[model samples]
Target: MHAITPYLLKSYKGRDTEKKESEHFDLSNIKGKDLLELLHKYMQSKSAHVYDFKEEKRVFKFSDIDFDIKRRTVSAFLVAGFYGVRSDIIDKSTGEIRFPKSESDAEVLRHYIQFTVPPGSTETIGLFHKSRGVGIKSLFDKLFKANFLLETQATLQITPYAHTGAVQEWAKGASVKSLKVKGFVPSSDITVNLARLGECNTEFTISPKIKKKGFKASFGPLSDFLTPEASSTQNEIITLLSNQGASVRTVAELNGARRTFEVGANSGGVVCDIPFAEGEDEVELKGGQPEFQSTQKWARSLTNDILKGVYGRRAFQI
Candidate 1:
């Protein structure tokens, strides 16, 4: 499985009272208590946890949470609660869609979150599924509020650590002249002006059907182009290409020469590989079994990767 590894950084401040100003507390400054234990208690309570998005309530549950005292680490899987789904089958002869109700209609999905708490450290690494909706930070914000667990008034933020070697190398290029987009399907019309004003530019517009198969384009260096249009600037064009699972390969002008670079696929988060052991078979689960053991294992493996500095120092640190 492909995963993204980001950092989870926490800071706490005391509630403001009339007598004194609110006091800030770093993870290192907290006295004699493990913050992860707060998470454990909340999960153990088995309260119904749901996230409101787009005016619809989606259920979520902390399926598996494990803390290792000796290693100072926490690993957990948050699963989307089971929802009923009806399977649709296309009739080859009649070209009609048929819906069938069966026990297989029950479906669930899970996302991963894991982090390590080193002694006296304020920042730790985190791993998250690459879904653009309802991100890791939002999930944590809903879970941990000021006094959600009485006396645990802590604020947490998860920010993308984008300063990696790959990104730095991309930035070092003199100017970007070309890019390729992948893994994106247009939900609506998308228009990209491939050149600036006063230049012979191709205004590339795509429909949902046409964009299903991704495309690549090239032009002169952006520096040589004229003023950007009101609708789309050079930066805007690049940002549009980078979003929604699109990776970019650019032809760049560097040191009076041109070179190709792969970049920005991980600008949202660092890409990690979750490979299974050779010759190890996957186990399929039935009723009364954990639905997301693979996800749980992947989260634990990513936490171990953080301790090994597999993603580089600055790339995983907050």
Candidate 2:
């Protein structure tokens, strides 16, 4: 058998204190993949999921297996997913299937559990170590200053991104702050006409940045902005623009503050309705990402999609 990869392990305190410093353990003996595969095998057995595991003097326990990894002696959980996910995704025989077929199993495994490298109680990876977004302001403050903006200076040929319900299912495991895709319902003017601009599958890149505060009650996190696929950002942007006029670059800029507020009122972000706009009109400004979501789905990468140019939405770098 191939040697398994090592891991950086740590304990997860409760939710209220989640943001605090944590304690870590270096699992010097077991490889991460080996540990996870063992957990998967055990989870398959209803009774075996919860059990004790020991490494030298350190003791660990997976108490009621609904994603909870605890020290055999304490009640703490482990910091898993994302940073420690390679072990879960890659298997010697199965390749890179990150999630299980059963929704129930996948959810439990992804959420509360962790095949992870836990950080020490005193560790810090610097202050900005977090999912990028205008947090408190997104919910309470009316103003969301642009963190960084990427407007298309020229015509951006969009690529058709595809996803089955399964890939989306996996996203929930790794999804950061965004709500799932099912949370959204497409707006009437939010058309997906691949052939909007003469011929199919193309969009004009007009300047898409506004100076002032953009929205009123924006919902979902930055991750929610990426819908079923990438480019979901520009897709929604064009859909709104098509309602006003159908050009790529010229009218793309919402020059006056008056018109900017209107865009928010009239349209939705990559997926969800901008909810409502306090201002008059707006456009995608840069800086920290401001994501969009209608009902569900979360691929915040910068795609041609809309709203947040993040999650899995891919933006062309010019």
Candidate 3:
């Protein structure tokens, strides 16, 4: 087997909110490739972005959000709610990011959660950070001797950095254009979802695509994504990607640390990391030397949690 070890270091700076803030992250796990494979799977999932969008009478109410990258975030994310999908509908339809750098394609998707509250109003609070200069594939490629170190980060303007909600990306490096989210059943309920203590999504715009076994890499236009041309199907594509992005807050913990993590991956599942304290500079893998089986174990665990969030399952399996 390929004994691939990884290392990573990252820092994040926030834009928009007052009292500008920044966070740092660290991750140098032993499960390098295993984690990478898992992350790859996550990015490839259909439910990673938005779920579903149905046009009905009275119109159950729904949302269509669009994200434009100002720069990269410290980490990327997967947010799943009511109506949307995480699957790479773009790849499925276009086979791959024809022009990942295209102002239109460089944008991030927003999942619209359609719900209803019997009597009183149901609030669907949402949290989001926007920026350009986004990128994800770089970190992915570094996993082995390969960086294994997942340097996830983006320079963003947290819509309400003070709020507890945000959006998720496959970590597929690309720039964002603009973001706009609206609609929820009853057209009133508000929803809020944020990256947990370790729930961080970040990246920079670096067009990376697969060409057989290697990547056809290139530099994507940063400004284009920031101001993409409006399209009729843009909203629909964004919705599809958003529904699939799924994440959950098990034990709500307010995390103000900006750190990065190392990773592993393959055809197997991915690794959902354990939170590392702030300023863990040059930190190594926790749990000592891991058995090959253990890597899969962690990947499986992360996959289950991700799936459960997407499907809302009490229990599950790959």
Candidate 4:
């Protein structure tokens, strides 16, 4: 089984955040021709996709390029690795070098990529998976920023699709009367009186047994945001967390609703595993082709499943 995550795509015109939010120009009636061309050039190696990683020169390559212009869907595989490490083998017995018999000795990392833009809609979703602690989303961000620019504007952005629906399900008709701080690390900018201690590290729990209390009442709007996926409340929380001058990790149990659940960093979205034959799912790079050659089909199936689960639409076949 393999996990796939979804992200929302947004485009901004300039550096003005307020104006960009007001415009909300996120794939709304986008022709997508220019973007498609850029991707084509990248896959063909006309434009190099290289990055420095741990003092090593790494190159990214895209293969199995499939797209549907009318449906606005693109699917490809991202293979990245260090450039040309081995060419020929050296004979230790005598001073001689010979060419390798096969090219399968080269090591590379791979991940599935899929993007879908609904017909004349503002919503766009890009499905990706992590490869060796790296994500293809970041590569796309750099790709667009370096190549797809519009007079120093038209920036491409990716916002993760949070699992707010799960939170809503747990919060509905349920009162979160307690929040326990597990590990609290103060930011360096802030001064804390540690007395004999050199640093400020604390663990505390705030539990109110009474319903409709102070902490509970003040948290109603955030609960509302989770229920409806409100962007305004989400932005406010983002600002508060970013500028809090401290790193806080909390764990709270949502009771009296459907079921109890935990909310934390990894609780942002759900991870689903796809059921596929092991051999069929694995993409072998023998002669630059897979042993089973079923990765593209697997990608299509997994993408359709995610689309059906998230957007209630399963018309994509590309």
Candidate 5:
């Protein structure tokens, strides 16, 4: 008759914080026991899944015999297989597989347990991971284009030029007190003129010596501007441009101004402005007029109203 032997298998060591909560179990240790019966007794003794068994050669095998801690769930692989078992088997003649006898050996089992458990439960594991990945990707894409813009002049020039006289004024010695855009919308062609505190040569170049003020301009789609994608692209372009030292403000400001201009124009506010050339004698200007003078005048007036803070105050006011 084969004698069944029962032995108390040590419990796995928990991590530092969990060490106090770990439990131990004991059973009868016997020799020449049937492997399956030994496993049943071990599993029943501790209410856990550790088991030891011997094969035809009397080689000992250690197994978890329960849920896979690594996979975060109970699975057949951890129950009936050799997951935590050693590769070497003991022979009755060789005495190869031996029971662990030291604290270090018990620690090995503890590590196996700690390494198997997942950080979080199976549910909601991938929640923020997806959003975080998208945000990082978008940020990098924007940053790459911004770096590309710094190296190319043509790319900078491709942006619609406002033709503000400040470019020329900055070339001259005159200090520009204020810069305003006239007849500009998200899609409108902007025209800017610089004025000095006093009369000067109209053909004179702006001197680099003058310290120019920072520029601030807002733009949005005209009433007739129909493309939504273009509007979004323009907003992104403007943001990138501002970061590159173009001195732009919030995109919200541009959208608000556009809405105000549209409503005001519909209510009979003029939408243009026209400027008479500087230093033009009355006789030289008496009969000369551009065919688009009226339209230009309307645009100038609307832009001036926007710059003077009238449009913004009215559009966004409570």
Candidate 6:
């Protein structure tokens, strides 16, 4: 389960007459009592963002929603009577204008219940809404399962000080070629490499193919990997490779393999040449140990493993 933390805020449009009507209702009027009672009754609907209150200006609100992924659950506190959390906005012509960000919406509704409601309000009610709907439930289930629940570690870390000056310089469109590092001893020098992060050496060709049957492979632009189609294709290739005796290994193994192959033939009759490792006595094995003449041995072994059952099979007749 992946967890992504997002910032949440309150929903505040310009204060209007309707707000005042609810804000300063006259207790003397029977309609006010009926209106308050109606509001209390309405706050009973179930949703993650609902809450109940009983005070002198009972601000009826929603509860704090718990988005769960594993059990495919979305338990929300609903403000029974009023749609306090507007999921969608409609223009004057009734066409939807803006849609709420789910996490933000949940946070907004939560803030309203926690901070906006007046203290000492009487008979405030809220509901918890659970869905069996295919679409709505499916979406909530996915967010709860995929985005909110998983543990994610930061793959890259950057300090604020390192980029702050560079960002300021770029914003000003200065022709600054170097960054002056601020903090250090008088005689000690701190050099920051601004170009290293974005610089790409396009002088060499990038090979996308893997020669091993048990290994996975992919191609195309890096951004394409984000799409579902691309992901499916990657998964398919991985499955095929896994079934064919190829497997994903550590970065060290891949790096070693990259250096090992000079010229090789795959089971599909695809021939290619890989670069030779310089100065090393022999190629490094997938296990990270240096093997004497094991490259050719492993290549033959893998090829035999992949072509186990079809050695003598004839080609299809025309």
Better of 1 and 4 by TM-score: 1
TM-score, candidate 4, is 0.47
Highest TM-score: give the candidate number: 1
What clash pairs does model 4 have? none
Error of 3 at 97 (Å): 50
Q: Which pairs, if any, clash in model 1?
A: none
Provide the TM-score for each candidate, comma-separated.
0.48, 0.16, 0.17, 0.47, 0.13, 0.15
Total backbone collisions for each predicted model = 0, 65, 118, 0, 28, 44
Better of 3 and 4 by lDDT: 4
User: Each model's C-alpha lDDT?
Assistant: 0.47, 0.23, 0.24, 0.48, 0.23, 0.24
| Alpha-carbon RMSD of each model | 12.2, 21.8, 24.8, 13.2, 35.4, 28.7
TM-score for candidate 5: 0.13
Q: After superposition, how far is residue 67 of candidate 2 from its true place, in Å?
A: 18
Put down candidate 1 lDDT per residue, 185-273, tens digits, no spaces. 44432323322322231222222223334642335343322223435555466556667434544455545544333344343235322
After superposition, candidate 1 runs with Cα above 4 Å error: 13-32, 47-56, 81-107, 131-136, 146-149, 163-245, 248-262, 265-318
Q: How much is 238 displaced in model 4, in angstroms?
A: 27
Higher-TM-score candidate of 2 and 5: 2
How many clashes would you count in candidate 1? 0
Q: Cα deviation in Å at residue 193, candidate 5? A: 34
